[model samples]
Target chain A: MKTRRSDRLVDMTNYLLTQPRKLVSLTQFAKRYDSAKSSISEDLSILKRTFQERGIGLLETLPGAAGGARFIPYMLPEEAQTFINELVDEVNDETRVLPGGYVFLSDLLGRPEILKRVGRLLATQYINEDIDAVMTAATKGVPVAQAVAQELNVPFVIVRNDSKITEGPTMSVNYLTGSSKRVEKMELSRRSLPTGSRVLVVDDFMKAGGTIKGMMSLVGEFEGTVVGAAVFAEGRVSERVVAKYTSLIHVDTLSSDGTGITVTPGNYETEVYENNNLND
Target chain B: MKTRRSDRLVDMTNYLLTQPRKLVSLTQFAKRYDSAKSSISEDLSILKRTFQERGIGLLETLPGAAGGARFIPYMLPEEAQTFINELVDEVNDETRVLPGGYVFLSDLLGRPEILKRVGRLLATQYINEDIDAVMTAATKGVPVAQAVAQELNVPFVIVRNDSKITEGPTMSVNYLTGSSKRVEKMELSRRSLPTGSRVLVVDDFMKAGGTIKGMMSLVGEFEGTVVGAAVFAEGRVSERVVAKYTSLIHVDTLSSDGTGITVTPGNYETEVYENNNLND
Candidate 1:
């Protein structure tokens, strides 16, 4: 089946975008497009250059008998900073501050465009990590986990506060809710995360890092290692139980009256920027 | 700044894909690529032909002063059938049968690849409908709603079984659970969904579709209309509460001994295929 080069580029680009971080060998592209290996190689060079020039992602190509190309999703530091600033602005509204100092974020977290950008930014932080699966607590964390998991091309396991009959068998852990100090149970399907897997834990918000700590311990239950943890936003607390985690925003202050709320960009600069390979 | 056709195609494909269902005027492309309007038109023609030929989607081109192109996501009936069959097979195992005849599907729902494909398949059913938002119950339905909402380029609203303090104000409704015949409550945020919006409700599974019905009525509370409802799978029930909906698979039987299990394709063929504009 002969294919035009222009048509091939569009099809190939669509394929690569859908398959982030997955390696595709030249032979596979050659056979799919019914083009010569050399033509396929040339096309890849164009793709690699275009991807890098446009800051879409990095298209890493290997040359040899077992050579292939893989798409690693990345965001430029400037773009990430701009997006984070926009997020900080979006949540800085006084009306968003609910009772008990919780900020209303489901509206932002539920948007696909915002989730896609957040997913890419968070995924960039763990691009090279051996992430076998993404772990998150139920309800709020589902969207965040799904977004990052899709970018990394890995499955996500939902930790539910209450076990459902549909899950068959589950393992539960009791942890103290950071600010509330109430012991709550979180559970995961025993079959969701296999033993020895490397997991990335994420959530929509962190209040004293109780939920993130619960997820890490749950990962330990399955004998899986916690590669890293991240949250969309972190509210200021007296003492943080979980250390070494990435967050996109910090809710600095929230008066009991719901006014005087202040927001700032989280530690993404030092965590994501310095660790990112875009400059390299 | 001049741009090559090959590079432009790569960038344009990525942009169109990320902005599904969004109309992009030729002028915008021309300015972004620093190319002539005629060249941008030519590039879109190639993209349209390639996207259609590859069954990626439909690139609808409008001609004139207000002319532009929009990508409508679609899946070929053949592909949908193939995918639905795989889903049926994946869940047909006897071991999947849990106590109370529940089929364990968290592992499948947690998978990003499966979720993406399922999202596209479900979204294909309502490509031509005016969908303002996607709605689903908390926990299982979040991923499904996210997937379809992303394809439709719309935000999803999650209906929770219990109201959270962070949601500010919410409206709740009581519905009877189909199989169990127990009355349960479902709620949605007062502000997440605007009034008079068209909503598409989706879920991971359905027995009597009590949950879907609950969501539809909740939409009514917001003065929103439910344009459609869909599920990833439907299990056998003496009577289903929801009359009109699309599903990918039907689990006809699960013996009490967990030995005799049967699964088949749902009404998606008649619903999705007949309604699909792929041939056009």
Candidate 2:
């Protein structure tokens, strides 16, 4: 189809956005739009500059016969801070406190916009890890994992607490629940991950980190390496078994009367910002 | 931040893509990009044309003092057919058949790209519904519902088969399992949905339609209206309890001996394509 440069720019931007972190050859674009390679190159330069200025992401151009452009979506430090601060305020609501000292986060996690922001923030931290897949437990963590996987353009595997007949052959691991301190089993289908894959673990909330630890063990069983773990929120527990993880927000305190709650920004904000600057 | 039209177009495209089916005023974009309203309008015009030509979606501009634009992401008929045809071919593998005639689909459902395509096709069916939220049963259906909900820029609520304390106050209901013909219970947190919501139920697979029917009843209990229902794939059964629903693919024959399988594009492809053409 014949198209103007303006039209090509718009289409190219949308195309790159949908397939973040994936390289697309200019020849492919040239063939699809029936445009000259020079024109496609010009369009990429425009898109790359715009993406960087607007904090949308970095558009890296690979220069060679096998070269193309790749879109790596990331959040600027200011944008990440704004998102986390807003999330902190949202989670500070007293109504979100439950009977067992747990914060009722289903409503927040269910919102696509919030999940996307949180996903971007977490995915930004590990964007350069060459992550092959994202893994999370069923129920609460699916959206978070899905969001991260979407941004990274990878598959997400859910570890279920119960074995379903439909999953076929499965690998199960028992781990202690961080809060409950009870040994619980988590299972992932054997076919979900190939051996030696690098996987990132994501969850909505973390306290004792037992679930994350369990996922680490399961990853080991699949012969996959754990790139890292991240969460939307983490409670202020004196001890955590799973270390080396990033969280967007940290719940400092939750009142028993459900009248007050305190949350603060997580430690990863500064780390992410500093790391991003160094990369640039 | 001051930005050129090239930068604004890239950012605006990203913004509109992230929040599909939601209206954004020109003033908002102008303010965000530090651009003039006329400039923003011109940028959107370029985006709208490109989006349409590329089968990305529809960009409906509302003109007036209070008007702006709404991005409705949809698949063109040919694109939809291509996606469904490819999916059918993928799911027709004999190894997917399980002992109880179930098909293993977690791998496909877990892929972000496939989920995004499935979400777009399903969301296109209800683009005009003004759906308030998407709902699904826990486990296998969460990703599908989340995908559809993300496409619609809405929240998705998961109805869990087992009620957790973290969900707070929940309403539970019992429904007959289609395959096993056993009575099973599903529960949803009361806070998940506000009263009088219009919910679209989504699931990964459907057989007897019992689960979809249960979700419909659950929506009714929440004082919400069932806008419609959608599924990734459905098993061929002579009888279905739910009459009104759409499935992208139909599993015609799952050989008990695990020798052969027949899968076909769903009945909604033509309908979706026709409706999409009408809207365009």
Candidate 3:
């Protein structure tokens, strides 16, 4: 198809956004759009500048016969902070407070735009960590895991509280439920992950971190290593069982009467921006 | 950030892709890139043509003070067929066959890329429908619903076999399990969908269409209407309970011996392509 440079630039940007972290040589674009290689090169330069200026991501170009351009999707620290702050404000609604100090998150997690932003923020922290898979529990955590997996272009494995017959041979693990202080069993399909895989654990909410810890141990059962853990929100508690993790929002206080809640942005914004600047 | 027209085109495409089906006025883009409306209009013209040539989607413009551009993501009939054909080839594995003619699909549904493609295909059918939300039964159906919901920029509600107190008040229904021929109960949070809302039902797989029917009835309970129903694959059963629905692939035959199976692309490809062409 004959196309103008402006049209090619638009199409190329759309393609790169969808296929993040994928390398596409100029020849491929040249043939796809029936455009000259020089024109494609100029389009890439324009896209790179736009992405950088807008904090959309980094467009890395490799200069070799085997090389092309790869788009790494990330959010600037300021953008990340603004997103989390908006989320924090949204969650501060008293109507969201449930009994037993739990906050209603289904509505928030169910929105695709919110989940995508949260995924981008978390994935930015682990973009270079060589992640092979994203893992989460069956219900609430599935969306978060799927979002992160999409951003990383990897498969996500859902660990279920109950094993269905269709899953075939499964591995089960018992972990203490963080908020309830009760023992609960989680199961994963044996074929979901191969041995020696590196997995990232993500969830919707983290209180005592027992569920994340349970996933960490489950990763070990498959002979896989846990690269990192992330959560959309974490409840402030006297102590957390899991040692290291990143949370987008921190729930510092929740009233028992369901009348008040206090939420603040997590440490990811500062840590990511500072780390990225230091590396640069 | 001062950006050139080339840069503005790239950023604008990225923004429209992420926020599909939403209206963005030309003035918004003008302000975002610090460019004039005339320039933004020219850039949008380029994007519109590219999107059309690549079968990406429809770039609709509303010509008024309240008007702008909306990107509607879609796949052409040929592309949809190719995608479904590839999926059929992937699922045509002997190991996927389980006892009682059940084919394993958790892994396929878990992959972000696969789910995204399936979501886009299904969402395309209902893109013109006034869908308020997407609905599915947990656990396998959540990802499919999430994907469709994401593409539509709407919230997805999960109906659970078991109710959690955190969901607050819920509406429950009982339906016959397609494969087991046993009646089972499903429930959804009441607040998930408001009265008079229109919902699109989605699932990973269908056998007798019992689950989809149940979801349809459940939507009625909330005074909501079922816009449509879609599934990734459907089994070739003697009878299906649901009258109207769309399936991406058809599992024609599954051997109990787990050595032979036949899968084919479903009726969606032709229906969608023909419908879209007629609309055009």
Candidate 4:
């Protein structure tokens, strides 16, 4: 079948979007579309420009037979700020305040649209880093970690509070959780994480940074390096054990009566701008 | 900035891919690309044909001013079968067999590529159904549920074995589990699942469907209806209780000594084909 240029362009866009961070040689595209290599190269140049102008991502091409095109997932600074501001407003609602001053965020976290945006925003910050795995605590953090991992095209590892037989053999570590000073155990399957990995820690929410700290320690046990950490939201803590991390939103206060709350965008925007030298 | 046809095509494809199941009017694309409505229509025709040919999805174009294009994700039967066979082979390994005849699936479940394929395959089955929400058990089932929810573009609700205050007031139910006959409690937040919602239940694995049944009961407690249930893999159970469900893989045997195991593609392919009248 003779494939038209328009058809080839559409199919190529879909291919690149689905295969993010995967390299596809011009020969591969040429063979798949039954077109000349020159035609495929022209198609890719159009894709690259469109993607960049739309803030979809960066379509990087490497010259020579050993190289090809790779789609690096990214989010523009303006778009990232807009999304974070919207997220902050939605999270600032008094209705989301639960008992014990904990804010209900599962609703937002469960939305694929919200998760995708959060994933792109967070993943963009680590695009230049060599991240082997995205790690998170079980239950709540699973969605966030999965989202970020999808953007980075890497597998995510879920650390559990309790071991399950279904996980086979596991390696565990103990850490103190919260100001309550209660010790908690976190474990991961022995084979889930390989040694000497570069890990990115993610969580749905952080308070006192105990869980994040525990994940970092667990990573160390595997002889892995913590590339960085990010959380969807952060709560007030007198002394956060984890000093360096990125967050999308910070909850300033929540009334004991659960009728009032305040939230603002986290250091994510600032960090992203500083790292990439993105202008306001 | 005068928009070129190639740039418009690439941008339109990205827009449609990102906004699955969304009704995007031609005017939206036309305005976004600074192109004429007729040109946008031509671009969509190319996209529609290319999307169909590539098996990326079905680009449905609705007529009239109120009508527009909707991207319904799908998987070709041959592609689905190939993926399932690969998955079956990967899962049949003896190393995955754990104590108590349970298979270690967390590693596969944690993989974004595997999860994305599983999500699309399962979501394709319920594409025509009106699924308002996707529900799952806490811990293990969260990833599968999130992936499916992402494909369907709906919010997912996590049913927990134990209640957390962060989830707010929840509705709970007790269901008898396994041959052990232990009654276990399952709960979901009151606000997470609205009354009379049409929910799809998803899980990583199903032994005897006790957990799925528990999720169904919890859904009922919230006055919601279960549209369907799907599991990544299903194990043998004498006189299966939940008669109606779809599974991607069937674990026929796993030696108690954990040395040998056998697996096969489940009724998923058969059902999908029969439902769609797809030929081999």
How many pairs of residues collide in each model?
A: 0, 0, 0, 0
Candidate 3: TM-score of chain A is 0.93
| Ranking, TM-score, top scorer first | 1, 4, 2, 3
Candidate 1: where is the Cα deviation over 4 Å? A275-280, B274-280
Predicted structure with the largest lDDT when compared to the true one: 1
Q: Tens digit of lDDT per residue, candidate 1, span A34-109?
A: 9988888888899999999998989989997478789999888888999999999999988888877878899998
DockQ per candidate, 2 decimals: 0.89, 0.83, 0.79, 0.86
Q: After TM-score superposition, what is the CA distance of residue B29 in candidate 1 from its true location, in Å? A: 0.5
TM-score of chain A of each: 0.96, 0.95, 0.93, 0.95
Off by over 4 Å in 2: A64-66, A253-259, A274-280, B1-3, B64-66, B253-259, B274-280
Candidate 2, residue B174: Cα displacement in angstroms equals 2.1
What TM value does model 3 have?
A: 0.95
Model 3: per-residue lDDT, tens digit, B229-264? Answer: 889888888888898888889885554555577888
Candidate 3, position A118, lDDT: 81
Candidate 3: which docking quality band?
Answer: medium
Candidate 3 chain B — worst ten consecutive residues by lDDT sum? B271-280
lDDT at position B118, candidate 2: 87
Model 4 ranges off by over 4 Å: A275-280, B275-280
What's the CA error at residue B154 for candidate 1, in Å?
0.1
Task: Please state the error at residue B54 of candidate 1 in Å.
Answer: 0.7
